[model samples]
Target: MNELKDKVALITGGTKGIGLGIAQALLSQGIHVAITSRSAKAAEETAKQLNSSATKARAIGVKADVRDFESQQNAVRLVLSEFKQLDFVIANAGLGHFASIEELTLEQWQDTIDTNLTGAFYTIKASVEALKKSKGYYISISSLAGANFFAKGAAYNASKFGLTGFTQAVMLDLRQHGVKVSTIMPGSVSTHFNGNEPDSSDDWKIQIEDIGELVVDLLKMNPRALPSKVEVRPTMPPSK
Candidate 1:
């Protein structure tokens, strides 16, 4: 882990929940982190929290709409300006709008794809050059929905499934350049995703911190070993 100290990472949609969780874990490893949110204020607030005196690592906040190529490019530039070299880029920004195919509006479906799928594309395109120079890692926070579709999850499922395939294709393209790419698909995480509050009863679900720890482990893995896709689930959960 000490080998990773002073490295840098940029996380998209990093203000709250899983993104923030990953930021915290990276900071703990002495990695400089730049976390982005659509809101400048929220991004700055969380960056400050992560860089508190106790942990006291370099952290920056940037406002970027991953849905836009220009915005994502600006974010990549900001991270380069702050940290010089980027060792990891996490395409963790996402959204979910659940509705049956007939019930889903065109706008809702478009927003989900734009945010959850195209956003990852924009982010990777913006960062790939820098990642190549650093021989870094690219990890996308895909979800179980990427593989399992539900009755009311047409928009969300389609976006994630596309994202899953997109990341895999990217992995094959970037690996020759010494950059590693992977996607993490998590199930039933105790997070604020989809605006759902996590209560005590949600403890049986995977914790956001658990995902963070998994990311750290991935980063620490031997460079020759790559777990290109990971599906995480709670060890014990209420039966279906």
Candidate 2:
């Protein structure tokens, strides 16, 4: 879209899956995109794969662990150094752990919460000033698990639920500053998230590209309108 042309966008955990999809979508629209991964190799590889002369410029990828505040901050800095401005930040890096409450270890709970919730906070806090300067957007890739509880998902559910609340409050707090914030909660995406293998057989699951398309739509929307929350699901999930 014309609105996204020349804008700079950053996506965390964007080496593959949903994050990569979003990066690709933005790049196709002429947006300058930056992506972060835990590994420098993965980041470089993904950027190479997404780059094309047609996209105007290749996406930039940086090594960043979202759980580390300094790392998150550095990722934003790298983007700014390369692009000269940061217009959007997508806090899409997250993890999930599934276990019944009685069986869940404290370590497992902490890992989930730290990566999924606290990591998002770190990424946003690092980018807040840049976003405010550009009057940009902050999008969180949450999950339906944030609202719907399930067996063996106590830790994952808690992290997501807390994230949902956090996203809403941040949206309200940032709106006054002309920075838009929104959360996208998707269910059962066909991606390698949380170590799940994605195969062609998993056609019933939500496609990663769909989430990418949604983010592009959000960027194209008028500044007067803000869809602070969006919940998406596969129209026809396979029957058990």
Candidate 3:
């Protein structure tokens, strides 16, 4: 925690869900954070909520659309201007568009691929230089669908699969620069993903804070080691 104090982290799609969870955890560790959302209102409101609970670190909000390369670039610039350094980049902005090939529309497919795959590329491209300078970490929130495909998940699966592979290749490319990169593939996380509301029924699913803790653990690991890729799921989900 002491080692992480005063460091800066940027989380995309951070108004809620896994990104917001990670932001909270980082701030609790005395790491300042900037959270981005497509809605300026959401970003600022979430940042205020984070600041209220912050102990030793501060929180700021930026409006950015990860699907746009220029938007991502501007976001990184804003963070750099405010924090003076970027120590961590969490590319957590992603969306799912699930449907069978026969039912999926071209718009749905494009949105999924653009937001989940190309968005991650834009995020890393925009922040890689800053990360290289700081020897920072880059983490992406992927999904188990990346590794295992299923019916009605064509668009979602393709996007996540691309994200997983992209993050791994990025890991190989950035390690020599001392910038760590990894992807977290989670299964059935209790978030408002795909319009499912979370409730007590979600108790058996992986929680956002759990992912946050995993990220913190990764950050605390010795520089000699890297987890590179992590696949996390509920230990005891109801039998299929």
Q: Evaluated with TM-score, which candidate comes out highest?
A: 3
**In model 3, what lDDT does residue 153 have?**
92
TM-score of each: 0.97, 0.96, 0.98
The per-residue C-alpha lDDT of model 2 at residue 79 equals 91
Stretches > 4 Å off in candidate 1: 53-56
- Give Cα distance to truth, residue 72, candidate 2, Å: 0.9
lDDT of 2 by residue, 26-63 (tens): 88888888889999999998888888543465688799
lDDT agreement with native, every candidate = 0.92, 0.90, 0.94
- How well is each residue in 189-211 modelled by candidate 1, as lDDT tens digits? 98888889999999899988899
Backbone collisions counted per model: 0, 0, 0
Give candidate 2 misplaced runs (Cα > 4 Å).
52-54
lDDT of 2: 0.90
lDDT of 1: 0.92
Worst 10 residues of 1 by lDDT: 49-58
Worst 10 residues of 3 by lDDT: 1-10
What lDDT is obtained when candidate 3 is compared to the true structure? 0.94
Instruction: Please provide, for model 3 over 8-67, each residue's C-alpha lDDT reduced to its tens digit, 9 standing for 90 to 100.
Output: 999999999999889999999899999999999999999999999898999999999999
